[model samples]
Target: MGEPLRGQAAVDQLLEVLDLKQIDAATFQGESPQVGAQRVFGGQVAGQALVAAGRTVDPARLVHSLHGYFVRAGDPTVPIDFHVESIRDGRSFSVRRCTAQQHGRAIFLMSASFQLTEEGLDHHGPAPEVPAPEDVPTMADWLERYPDRAAAFAASPQAVDVRYINSPGWVQPGDRDPAVHQRVWMRIDGRLPDDPLIHACALTYASDLSLLDSVLSIHGEVWGPGGVIGASLDHALWMHRPFRADEWFLYDQTSPSAGGGRGLAVGRMFTRDGRHIASAVQEGLLRRIGG
Candidate 1:
């Protein structure tokens, strides 16, 4: 949210960032966006760490889940070193732990599980009915209506095409009624390779973008200015079925609980045709500003 992240073309820059460099058999290096960001975006570190974990895994194995915690604020100017540890390899699943560090200090830690494809009993709830993505307004469209915030929006990175069912989290809470849930349709703005890992990693990067907004919905609060400032404590994601991150998917998100200076949000991703593909959970520390 500092400067436009150095590229009008975001996905390309993101692709380069996620493409970690191998330093050793178990270590990889990645760089944050070349901007004056106060801190590295958590998603970049997590996604890069996942890439490190995946590279050390069997090609036949695909990552199904990942849980990560923000250990420290990462330096945006420094390169991150990701160290992967093989926790176990069973007949069906391979587990890995990754630590992302900057200047010898661990900034993020993650554990991921990769599994061979297998048939399983499956059932899921129906996707909620909402206006199609085409019928919704994009950030660009909203910027036209809110001239005051247009400059800030223009200066921020736009890697994904997002259509919000509710107003964006940066909107003042008192400006509108509380949303039943914070819902948005999103996808990478550009085409990607057919690699499933890339798609997964892309989604992982995109996942952290707006998840905390669901938590803010509870108090009719947004982020910045009249709302609360928050930091992600941990994030967990589960890939349910195959899906492309470059295609439109509905992220139906809500906060089930909030207290003790923290709030939790859970979200489900549904494809255009309404198949549930993934679920994500995140908790963040929220502090009211100017209270």
Candidate 2:
């Protein structure tokens, strides 16, 4: 219904969206930013659902993983009601289920598990070599270079800075070369409150923005008219190590397969110094505009 906010304003709005209003022990209320989209952003719903679930668990227990399904398109104009269910609580782990509803219908579903911090053996693959985030083209550069996508780049919230290692799927044309992987550097542009749950929720929101890009990259397809259109069907994320979402992180993504009008993308998040932080997987319905 309105234009997107930028800079600190944007991140502030995002924070507001994530701060769900507690209606009762297991119920919370949330709303979408008036960005004029017919459907709410998938990331917003996912983040809000996580917020609701996090509120039900003990603060000492940190989220280790979450899985969510986008059951239906959420109407941004209406308020979203989230109901959290106490699924289970073991000595070291707690699980909760959350559902987002609008107009008496379910729009999203999620389950999250949290665990007490424990010392454990750990090892992960090193981060791939990539240009420093500062060296990558800024959004301003994209506006000047990719005139076709300037509108989108301009409208995007400046709260989250994104620098692509490859052309975005929206900018790719039929003649564009196919790629097996898509690498992007992104971070929340504003500082967030010192809460691990907030940071994790922020990362969960950011994760949804790009996973689908890798899916389209595999086929050299674009988005919108004359290209392929898509919607996220399900998303799952696992946090391996504690990291701040406000800092730059490398999102290395790849698509392994696509069939039956669906594509799966897997991504690994790594810190600048090569520390693997988290992993995300998503499958989306991709329909060719004109097949």
State the lDDT of candidate 1 residue by residue for 179-258, as single tens digits: 75999999998888898999999999889988999888767887888779989999999999999999999999999999
- Specify the poorest-scoring 10-residue window by lDDT in model 2: 149-158
lDDT of 2 by residue, 1-291 (tens): 224466678899899989999999999999887756779989889999999999999999999999999999999898999999999999999999999999899999999999999998999998989889988877667656667666654554556888888867787565468788899998997889999999999999999988899988887888887789899999999999999999999999999999999999999999998999999999999998877
TM-scores for all predictions? 0.95, 0.96
Which residue window of length 10 is worst by lDDT in model 1?
1-10
Against the unseen true structure, what C-alpha lDDT does each candidate score?
A: 0.89, 0.90
Clashing residue pair totals per candidate (backbone < 3 A): 0, 1
